[model samples]
Target: YRTKIVARSQNNKMHTIISWSIPLGNNILLSYIFAYGLGNHINITSILLPTIGILFIALGNYMPKTQRNRLVGIRIPTALNNDINWFKTQRIGGLMFVVGGFMMIGGGFLGMISEFWTIALMILPLVLITVVPIIYSIRSSHKA
Candidate 1:
């Protein structure tokens, strides 16, 4: 039964230790806990906003790579019916995703804005990002 403890250093590095000691209850292995600086405040919005931004960017890049299948990527009913519709929609959607992703990344920095403006900023981009692609996909299906 052993325990390991890792500590943060002055230069913001980690020190790893291998400890072998007495066994725990019922010969259980020792648990491990990694801790950052004490009293470190993490900003939730900062982490989430960039994560979502990166997701959109990744999705944008992925859209072009995916084949038209019911299981993955953007799966709209109308778009699903036609390959040409799917391809065009994906291309436009990919572009929108890239734009939307950048907008979300930019929104992550709006910590100083008023709540009203913040909501407006985020909502508008979201609607543009998602709704427009759906509309475009549906319309293209009609044309095909």
Candidate 2:
């Protein structure tokens, strides 16, 4: 992880990390405030699920811009070892995130009616975002 932290270029890694972090951090902070501080006044699921979706979309938008760094993007051995895999993985991962974001937003709405369906939709995206990129990185590395 220490080795991974070393910046490969003058791309201002901290800026990238900070750019990614701020929205996510704000979302989490607001979520906490909304969920706990005003839990009684607001519907937790309505705000939370959609906020999570926006975070996912924001992350997805940032993914392609992420260079190989310990702090962000898809960080698997195969992706980390090479630039090609890193970019491809990030691109696919970004797409997955965006797709997942939409599903999650839909889940926020659908959740009101069917909690089970919302959970099912939400879980599949989470699984795909985690698994697909790793698998793609591995397979792509093999091809090279």
Per-model TM-score versus the true fold: 0.66, 0.76
Candidate 1's C-alpha runs over 4 A off are 1-38
**In candidate 1, what are the lDDT values of residues 1-144, reduced to their tens digit?**
111121122111111111111232113211211112444455445445555666677667767655666544567998778888888888888888888877777776773455554455567668877898899998888776
Give model 2's TM-score versus the native structure.
0.76
- lDDT per residue (tens digit) for residues 1-144 in model 2: 544545534335435655776787687768778767655465456666777787788788778777887667888999989998899999999999888988888888888888786787789879988998889899999999
Question: Which candidate number maximizes lDDT?
Answer: 2
Give the least accurate 10-residue stretch of model 1, judged by summed lDDT.
11-20
- TM-score: which candidate is best? 2
